[model samples]
Target chain A: MRSHRFYTPWLLMLPALVWLALFSVWPAINTITLSFTNVHQLTGGHYIGFKNYWLLWHDPHIRDAVLNTIVFMVICVPLLTFLPLLLALLVQRNIRGIAFFRTAFYFPVIASAVTVALIWKWMLDDRGLFNNLLQTMGFVHKTVPFLTDRWLLLLSAIALTVWKGLGYYMLLYMSALGSVRRDLHEAAAVDGAGTVRRFWSITVPGVRGTMILISVLIAVNAMRVFSELYILGGATGGVGGQDVSIVMLVQQAASGSDGRLGYASAISVFLFFLTAIPLLFLTRLNKNNQEES
Target chain B: MTATTAEDSREGRKRRVRGTGAVRHPDRKGRSPIFDAPTPHGLFFRYLALIIVLLISIGPMLWELSTSLKSKAEDVYTQNIQLLPHHPTLGNYGEVQNTIPVWHFALNSLTVAVINVTGNVIGATLAGYVLARLKFKGRKLLLGVFVATLILPAEVTIISKFQMITSMGLGNSILGVCLPDMIAMTNVLLMRNAFMALPREVEEAAIIDGANVLQRMRYVGLPSVKGVLSVISIFAFIGAWDDFLWPLLVLQSPDKLTLTVGLSYLNGQWSHDPRTIAAGTMMALLPILALFLILQRYFFRGVAQGAIKG
Candidate 1:
């Protein structure tokens, strides 16, 4: 029986539905349509029949963006996936002052990307702390070009991203670790299995699903990275301006009065496919898990 | 073994709680003990590892705070890196204010964050309650719309959201920055999951008593979802307060910049001063960091209740 009046549910859902329809659903479809046109910030044109895609196909910056993204994903996915799990394992047990450790570890995750990246940028500057230390130790006679050089800058941002992400993924793994049955651990220990042995055999399998889910999250985030690269490499994306991510390129295209809205929309559509495929597959797996259960 | 005894006590407590309607108080079961087998041999190593990670995590923030405090008298770029400020002063913080309208930018950030938190609390709660409890046509489809949003990354939708907001002439305004994120889909789905986990029998009893939907929701629904509410509010605050890219995109007028955007502008455009920049970073960071420290237990408590199971 309907306990509420007919309009009640619709009344409740109005704000959320409005937001979704206006911002999310409309933008998603409109992005595709806008990609085909020759729309700029101040002027517009009719369908250009893949002209923007043609430009994207040849853009040198686009080439750098893709290459940088691949390098970022290759290194970050494995490091972020496993390191956080280990951090989670380290802080898993209820011990004296564990809460303090947990809170401290989570500080980077809570701090803004701009703030953390800026902190790193300061340290990485020529006269900054690391360079001064290196010079004092006689390891380098001169300062390191951490921020200006393209490769060093990229590596620095990657390190910053990995460092910032550890606590977040650790939290996710912590929750998953809570559900791993303790009896199994005790059983394994009694059977002469060591801590590492138990962790590999029991702990890994128990949180295996979570590990997969986190890797997907890491992969998608790696693909869409913007703020770290933006802050560390300045707005122009480091020395030769080739350290930019795809999102940075979209931001560049969509800004300014002469902004190429159509080109940016095309890039957005391309990015949606790159990042969304894994998540959609994960959703499918989630559905199947629910069904079988 | 001590591990077996601890497990037995935990098991016995669960059975007793189960007899009493299985109403698990969130505070009690939050500390799960998979690694609680305190082998005296492992304690030293565990503490050692914990301290090592703690230093790595918190050391940068501390260094930043110290840098912000140091006076110009001390050589800050020393090889040994003096962490303690000699003549520690709030002078650099005042300098950050002088450099850019940092306080005004912080106020702008506060406005955006407050709007977002208020919006999510009301909008996501109502929508989440209806989808979870009320029997309505198209409920599944409505939930699907929120779920569908998950597949598309927020960056993908940025150009269109920007187009819509600027077309509405809300560009260069904080409201425009707040509009797109106010009722985040994840928060809505989180709330729905929270409400669904509430036992329905009590709500049914309210229904039997001729309580209307809003009445039942106000009396029964709101109380049970406090954990989820707190979690979402904390996150919404952090998301808006610390956000950089969106505000940077929307606000062009220098006077209207948020803290993160403003600090970045200071970094990129200003005649550079490390002390002043460090001070700006700390001002934007410490308040939110303090807030997180206070409310974090609630966050873990909420997660442990299977709120993320959805």
Candidate 2:
């Protein structure tokens, strides 16, 4: 190996190291420290030792957020995990003008989360296209309050998340599918296997590891739902103000001039642990996978 | 010839198989044989599924575009839904600006994206080169610092970041909004991977020629990593442009707000007129969409490489 002066590598890495210290490492430590205090947006405070966590434990908003997060995860993990694999399979084959189809599907993924949510919000407005179409078709005379209801608002956000997520995860699966045996389905077909049958026995097992990784990704992403719900359910979580997520709770606690920075830090610590469960599970699964392999 | 269509009609399919549904593979004619030549029914269902997914993915954005173009004469909301506008005009786009400084906010967003793109490209390139190519002590430990942060989702650290920005007197500033993400660890690691893939023979050859680290990197490493550099820059620009939560927390002044923050403000403050909101959304969307369209080859390639390596 070619030797370098002791300061050379350090010189090259200085900028990134400064950024890591200032942004990632320091903030991680400060978040835990600040959670023990009662800091606001404008004021610093002495440590009260878990009082903020105590309040968070009893907060009704936290309960609503927890319930909403669970709902978001339960629906999203299964749906996002399976649908994108089919989408990848659809676009993976070489056919006429396949490149155009592949890029076009990823448009929603490229668009900002705010823009798509706004587009969806406009479409689902009381007199918007969907409601208007329903009324015109004599399906319903009155408008549906999709954005105003608690459960519907949450569901609408989940739908938007899945819609935008399809192309992103499709890309991931597309890459993973590159390694799969191309002719296995044909062999399985001679055993009288149907399309779904081939998918379960062949494709699913082939990319079982990717599926597990994607499920963990979906779970973690679902827990961090913000822009979709924030836009669809209004700033205060629609009418009932209860269709909120954990990240939404973080934003609410630490936003505006009267923001509770300490309380928000506590909630953030909670959100961190919430996301870590899946990540830890993934690590454990990976270890098991390694042992088997 | 547009990139949107499933198949352009001008490229004639000479096979002329009627109703059997096997459209001749126009491009990739040679490799097509090695790939599965789908039967007529299979081709039909595949294209059908492709069309359906295409609709579900982009149909709303199209509807939003159509809604944004309708003139004042047309009733936006009616019992009989009319997708085709009676009269189309660009007035709603102007209305979005008059109500809020839409272009000004877009300019601010561009500034942030430009700064971030520049920062990530230059900074990550240096850090990645040293980490991957240079021999140094504690290099693995330095890399571990970068990898560990990937586990901490950016959002969880927002509270502390907000605190630090305020403490640094960067609150309500664009610099504050752009700082934390300027050298994202993901991009750095990606660049490191790219540099690592460079052939060791060239580096050895460069050393034999008495080329220092800078010259060796510039000649050997830089040229190969250019593709990945461009890919990460595109991602950086898009991330900075589309970002919401961080900008929302750090920026408070109406004038300094990015497009995302401004668009949301427009939603709440000018809660009337769906047309104007749609117009605002389009303005934030179109620039990045155009960039992605032009460079989608690189985008797909980058993501595929990223997925494989990751």
Candidate 3:
């Protein structure tokens, strides 16, 4: 009877387990299998060995994607890590109209990625609002190329990405902050620590676990950026000039005008690893942080 | 215990400092410096930070509002873009609906969100209760598996999930949008945390009174975790409602498109005159804003309580 009871939890969890296996696990395996095959339209192509991987390595577009993705990830992860912690700190106090502030911060989160991209696209347009506003304010004499300019485009994307994402991470940090015992804060305060000192000594250490978690989450998300970049016409997997991100390159290889199955697979395979490395490091960091906390 | 006394004294001091209606409102002046005491520079810094955050965060939305009110002629050559409209008009909103079927897209989003929310609530609570209350084998393993899913980025599986849905004929339907998301892992973790935080004695008494697992769960566990369930459901609703990529890939027909996808189509066309697109986008976001307002009070309290409980 006791043994039978052991299976009850598994039985209860069966639906979710089944859903993940069928929808998530099987599809991943299939994607890997399909990555190696040639596209024959109907029957699909024969098993091509490392031909795809080889082609992916040599392709200039694929190479550009790899470089671009690295740059975006490197730049974004740190910004993503710090901004939310800062926002969480700023809003950690129980202020009036906190709900309004929260909703305001999270508004971008609720806004569709497409809407976000569109709004940014309009603002970034040469004759658009951003440049016009800046021009009027004497910030710039001419219309700044927010989208068309290669360097500026990446920054704008990062800005939008950070804006959309900051609130969710802030909320997570806020909740984690709430869990911290007040005694530590009291102790620090009594020791003549300033607000910043108290936060560093007591609050920061208290939410160390959450910080690591947020870091891992942000790193993984930053590495896998696609839709917003894609929508911004960064679809060409060339060395520069739109299609600038690595995910875009994988996408181009997957379903481009070229239709190179092997190349697409290789690019995806690289991306998988690129994303995985940071994620692995992140996990280790989180575990270490949790233990230390 | 010592903290409480310290907090009370601080509260008394805060009342003294404020001086207006001090006795009536025992303000946060007590306790620790973190919550109660205001530094001389704190309000200035707070407002400055708040203003900066609001600008960075709310700047784009304000830009959208400005563009939406701009005339097509003005939009093309408007040199000075004040956040306030020169001449605000509902013409864009009027034209947007006629140009594209906005209501159809909204309906699709609503249907998907509603179904997804219902599925999550049922599955999450039941599973959460069992994980939290029942002494079952492999519970820790199951929890580990659920937590592991959080690490598996949705982008990695998008291609595969699309293929699965298309093959299953669930593609292009509202079912496709909701089905995959219905078995959400984050909410399961949330619900489990909420359930676990409920005192053990209630369940022990239920068991002592000869109540079975199902009965006890129905009467005690469900009620206790309802707050968490609402929060998770709201989150799920928002996620499903605002989704873009999945709907873009699956829903091919213009009529079948969700609001976000439909707005994207509008955006590409009206790249010149984006006022209409902005109006449409704002319309799409209105329902969510309304929902948040209606449940504003509960959301913060419930989420904070649940997180602390975890």
Each prediction's total of clashing residue pairs, residues at least 3 apart in sequence or on different chains, is 0, 0, 9
Report residue A144 deviation for candidate 2 (angstroms).
1.9
Scanning candidate 1 chain B in windows of ten residues, the lowest lDDT window is: B18-27
Give the per-residue lDDT digits (tens) of candidate 3, residues A206-292.
887777667666766777777677666544521255446665565554442334544455555566777688678876876786898
Q: For model 2, state the Cα shift of residue B180 in Å.
A: 1.1
In angstroms, give how far residue A38 of model 2 lies from its true place. 0.6
State in Å the error of residue A33, model 1.
Answer: 1.1
Q: Compare the candidates by DockQ and give the number of the best one.
A: 2
Ranking under TM-score, best-scoring first? Answer: 2, 1, 3
| lDDT score at residue B5, model 3, on the 0-100 scale | 74
Superposed by TM-score, candidate 3 places the C-alpha of residue B57 at a distance from the truth, in angstroms, of 2.0
Instruction: Give candidate 1's error at residue A9 in angstroms.
Output: 0.3
Residue pairs with colliding backbones in model 1 are none
Q: What's the CA error at residue A216 for candidate 1, in Å?
A: 0.2
lDDT of 3 at A29: 69
Fold similarity of candidate 3's chain A to the true chain A, as a TM-score:
0.86
Share of real interface contacts recovered by each model?
0.78, 0.79, 0.49
Give the best candidate by lDDT.
1
DockQ-superior candidate, 1 or 3: 1
Q: Rate the local accuracy (lDDT) of all candidates.
A: 0.87, 0.87, 0.71
lDDT of 1 by residue, B35-86 (tens): 3436565798899999889878888888888989999888888787676998
How well does model 2 score by local distance difference test? Answer: 0.87
Error of 2 at A5 (Å): 1.4
